[model samples]
Target: MALRANRVRLGIFFVLIMGIFITGIFWVAGGFSSPVTTSYACYFGWSVGGLNVGSTVEYNGVPVGSVSAIEIAPDGRLVKVVLNLEDDKFRVDDTIVASLFFTGITGLQDINLESLPDSVERLWSEDQLTFESDMPVVPVRSGTVQSVASGLNAVFQSMAQVDMKELNDQTIRALTRMNDLLDSVENDSVAVRLSRTIDNFDAVLVTYNDLGNELTAAIRDAREDAEPIVEDLKEFTGELDNLSEQLNMMGADLHNTFNVTNSILQEIRELLPNVNRLLDGFSGGYRGEEIWQ
Candidate 1:
């Protein structure tokens, strides 16, 4: 029985040794916990948020280092956080920023390390530290959201205080005035006056039509009566033409009688002078014969 108990104890011891040997082989082969000595410093006026000593440092989302120390200058102006990296990662001669970032809304913050393009050799010595709040200039999304919400609240409050009664009263007054205007236009007296004016115009048109017809009939009668008299005047004109020819012949004969009388008068003028001379000689001879007797 004692031999059997010793065999079981030896078996347990062998299993324990094999387990530790396998774990050591796996750890060495996987190259876990490979530490590299690289130093980085925070600038003056910069901060690492809430990170403390021994906090894990990440580079490009991969674990590369850890925070070794955090300190403030004797002047109380500059803060510094030194990190030791195991991934051969080193900072250039430029400024680096350390910020606090939350992966979600859970308020759990992590250390975010970033480098700036300023001269680090001019500010910090080798293995020294510095810090700043304006290192990366984190934008405040929550603050902007709060400002927008406040503006919307003020607009809604102003709208709630408006008075609607005056607007409704003005609308009602306008509607009442429009109804009264329509009622006045629909009155029976106005309709009757329009109808009478139209009837008077129709009567005037009928009177003008009757006058036109009378004037046309009078013109037709006058034309018919003057046509017969015009024919009689034409016949009278032919008789007047024959009478003018007879009068012309009689005027010619009267002109010839006047010419014959003028010739007889001229002969009598010549014979009168000869007869006077003969009568004078006979008178003187008769007087002497009477004396001799």
Candidate 2:
């Protein structure tokens, strides 16, 4: 009986050791954990497709955790996805918006947590999720679907804003007016009038051109005719200047002759006085002049 008890005791110890070994293996493989994890609920306003259990949860594209559970609301209007973030130190505030994003073409959905570019939302580290309150929820965003919808919405809005009937009426009126104008231009009398006006314009242009040419030719001819006159005038002026020089020389010679004549007369008068004394003895100065005459 003592031997049987020892065997049972050894078997129990071996079983306990194996159990511990298995638990350690599962722990290392992430089957269980002692670390605290954060949980948040994502209430998708839109459809959640391609998402299943164990979908990846990423913050700014970095893998941080995964979707832990999924359930529909009581009203069947929303799908709440519970996310388990492992060791996330940061608190999710209004600045962080959670959205559904694509991992690849595989159609696998991922939770994308990101900060809004406009920064309208505040970033708070102290904001904690209250257990009694409604789970802090982020609305899922359909990236491609939302973009396509927005673009289509804008296009539809613009198309709706246009008054198609009014636009068509204005266009028709404009076309009718243009047709009337075209019909008026197509009239035979109008065509003839237009042709006459064009001919008159052409004739005026030709006349102006001919007048310009004739004026240029006349000016050339006048310049040619004035050339000989200008040369003759230059020659006449030269001759006049020469004649003035000759007259000035003649006047100078006359002046010198007059001066010499005056001096000779004075000498003669003096001599006459002396001669009269002698002419009183030999026919006085006036008597000599009368004889000379």
Candidate 3:
């Protein structure tokens, strides 16, 4: 009987140990004890762990719950997810946002979770709320490179389609015209005329230089001769001034003498006429025989 009792006690202990081990396994797999639930509503296109479970719930890099259902009402697309959060920081009305991020050099993709700006104070609860994700903005490097390549291709195509024969003909025509113009200038008599003109210019310059020297010498001689003539004229003008003073007094005496001569001439003219009349009367009396009367 004691041996059976011992066996039964061992069995009970073994079962308890097995139960504890099973409970620990479940706890480890489930990732914690009964955490507080922070319910929220997520949009339809959000995903978790490569699986878009309609609207999924996550907290601190661990999946907590999945979307129970989805519906579209007048307020827009609504998604409801059941959350099992371990902390009180995640509560109702908190904004949930998802972001796509790249990992590894091969550009593997993963979704990152973050609360929307100012979503901390407004925590989520068991209520219909909105969740948003930034729109994916594609980089435009490849488009820019393709545009540059297209421009280069158009330029090369234009150059390749050029007419080489027409260009060569134009070049040849230009060279021939240049040769003809050169030949015309070479055959003209302009070179001989230019030489003659240069010789005449040289002779003219020589004549001009000789005439300039002659004019310089003539000016010097004229200035030397004019000096004495100027002094002589000055002395002559002084003498004429004195002679004019004496002539002025002599003219007054000549005026008085001329008046006396004019009076004597007038008396002589009157006596001549009276003497002729007296002679004519005496001659007539003698001729008529009574001369005394």
Candidate 2 lowest-lDDT run of ten: 283-292
Most lDDT-accurate candidate: 2
Which residues of candidate 2, in runs, are more than 4 Å off? 1-36, 88-91, 117-134, 139-142, 150-170, 187-293
TM-score of every model versus the real structure = 0.34, 0.47, 0.26
Clashes of 3: 8
Query: What's the lDDT for all of these models?
Result: 0.50, 0.60, 0.44
Model 3 ranges with Cα > 4 A deviation: 1-5, 17-33, 44-96, 99-111, 115-293
lDDT of 1 by residue, 169-213 (tens): 654655565455545543544445446545655655565565456
- Please provide, for model 3 over 202-285, each residue's C-alpha lDDT reduced to its tens digit, 9 standing for 90 to 100: 655665565556556655677667665555556556555655654564454456445545654555564455445434433321
lDDT score at residue 261, model 2, on the 0-100 scale:
51
How far off is residue 81 in model 2, in Å? 1.8
What's the candidate order when arranged by decreasing TM-score? 2, 1, 3
Number of the candidate with higher lDDT, 2 or 3: 2
Stretches off by above 4 angstroms in model 1 are 5-9, 29-34, 44-49, 87-98, 106-108, 115-293
TM-score quality measure for candidate 1: 0.34
